[model samples]
Target: MTSTESSSRPYGAFPVRIGFQVQPQHAEYGQIRRAVAAAEEAGVDIVFNWDHFYPLSGEPEGLHFECWTMLGAWAEATERVEIGALVSCNSYRNPELLADMARTVDHISNGRLILGIGSGWFEKDYQEYGYEFGTAGGRLDILAEALPRIEQRLSKLNPQPTRNIPVLIGGGGEKKTLKLVAKHATIWHGFGDAETVAHKHAVLDQHCADVGRDPGEIERSVAVSDSPEKVGQGLLDVGTRLFTVSASGPDYDLGLLREWISWRDEQNK
Candidate 1:
């Protein structure tokens, strides 16, 4: 790997890995469960569901399942593949309580959990759940405060996390979000094309430097929309190693996932 690729990650290199986000909406739980199983068998490095009370696309009132509860079941269902939300809304649960939930799930998965969290943006979720729908800056502030609390609680939990329980903070806010990523995240998930993500990577590297952290300590993750052949190399040429592709129910097709997995295998070789 070149300096351009590992500039932020200096300790060791991260192999190209694929992640699948199984959106739990407009489908039965049975179908959702099956999708996760198939993704693991198909060879994804991670499995994720979004943290929301409703559908993010299509019908606004479509059938949906809660995030953490489904994760509890996934922990028991899959023997491989790390599991968590693409980004759990930090405002939806008390940070300490969220930490315990993550710990319990970590134990259930025998340590295959990734706590992906963010400052949240869905207004309907807050209104329906009766959480304070505050300003974007306010929400980010709340997320900033909550991360430390979650880490502290995780340290005090009974058995402690099986591992440090990798924290994946999702967002591209150059200011607050990247700074938090520099300070705490084991993985930083963001959206955008190669150029955009490269800019974010540089900003994050500066943040890492300012905080006296090794830039390479954090893995860069990005979401993919096109075929691997179309979007993969551009991202890899930069620093992104964990490429996530999202699938929505009812079918939750594994074709896209398989393509990405195959591409990952080729890249790693």
Candidate 2:
């Protein structure tokens, strides 16, 4: 569907979603499990892992793990918080198949699944997997083609999602990426400073206008400074309902997470 078409209804309550990208490329399975448990007990809104074969930071050859497999385990492990990869690579798997996998996870989580995705990046993941690491434009083009197929497959799946599986797209490319967000995403996770985020939010609004969709219908999300007391009110003022902070191994620091969760509580109060 085009961006102008208002695809979904207005989002419910200003949800203070705190997402953690528990980097799997450098931690043991037991350590990762413990971190997930900690985040859930601390009351984080969503738990995320990245889709990569090697560590994105520190030593590239350090302990690493796969994405979807861990997600399956996470679906069974965490009872309260929503779970998914921070952004699954669209090129990694066939779209229809990916939809079915997401559906399976949805049931596993008892309806608490967020299908976060993005056009594939990371050259190492491509080369090692024996998949062609095409040009950036080419990858985005592939994503453009794949999203619709994935959505269509969701409808045809037998059991269907227990709850409407929230589709989250992460990227900040103005031209095509923002346009895709305007068309499909229930939540848009972006990166950058407040100024950059504000500009992109405006651009997204224009895309909404171009597509005839209400810009407010799409929830704005971002990865912010770990200290919420410093940026919380400011970010809240700018229409960002979801705030994510990324943490990698070998030590998964939850200090900032705790602060943000407290801030979230204060905001609600």
Candidate 3:
């Protein structure tokens, strides 16, 4: 798909979504709360925490926290911003159980939850938690098999989700991953530069076509660096309406988040 393929000029107004991945690895719970509060106040569209036991970067043994517990707290603390893991590891919990947990949190947030998920990748998370650290292909196979089951479980669950819980899937592998996104995801969290993202999006479009799903139905999201001006317009032009910036803990940087939020408002207006 070309950059213009996702433009609002053809689809009316596409609201820009600004997401902040509040890294829980190094920051204190209080600092996280304050940062979330600040982002909420700044008018961020989404507030995300990563699902990891250890720090992904910097000091590996640095301060860290669990994913769901923090999300539960965030559900109570934040008033407006949608909350979820940037991408939950599907291997950590059973698909049915994960659906229920997501449903419960959805209600807790008053229907403000995004079930961001991905095939498990971090080997340490699995080994330390007593989960078998399978090969990458095996894990992706698991994810592909589990996603439909998760959707079915969501339907069968009593009371149901407070809203149609948006399922955000991260990863850019073209063959299986993009096909899975075409089949299951409400949002596709892609990585890489604009050209790379665009190419993957084209592949996803083809996958959607093959599956008889509308390509535009899946929102394209990306993890951008601190510099918005450098790549913002290019990404937007390529159907990436949702942009997330990741910040690690100890010193939760709200500065970059504010700028992105402002940019979102400007673009939308």
Per-model TM values vs. the true structure: 0.96, 0.94, 0.95
C-alpha-based local distance difference test score of model 3: 0.87
What are the RMSDs of all candidates, in order? 1.7, 4.6, 1.8
Which 10 consecutive positions of candidate 3 have the poorest summed lDDT? 4-13
Model-by-model lDDT, in order? Answer: 0.92, 0.85, 0.87
In angstroms, give how far residue 135 of model 2 lies from its true place.
1.1
- Runs with alpha carbons beyond 4 Å of true place in candidate 2: 1-13
For 152-200, candidate 3 gives per-residue lDDT tens digits of 9999988889889999999998998999999998889989888898898
Error of 1 at 128 (Å): 1.0
User: Stretches of candidate 1 above 4 Å error?
Assistant: 1-12
Candidate 1: pairs in clash: 8-215, 8-216, 9-216, 10-216
Compose the digit string of candidate 2's lDDT tens values, residues 1-269. 12122123243245667887788857788999999999999999999998888888789778999899999999999999999888999989999999999999999999988999999889998998898998988999999999999999999999988977898999999999999999988889998766677788889989999999887778888997649877776666566778887778878889888888888888766
Per-residue alpha-carbon lDDT of model 1 for 72-151, expressed as tens digits? 99999999899999999999899999999999999999999999999999999999989999899999999999999999
* Model 3 vs. true fold: TM: 0.95
Winning candidate number (TM-score):
1
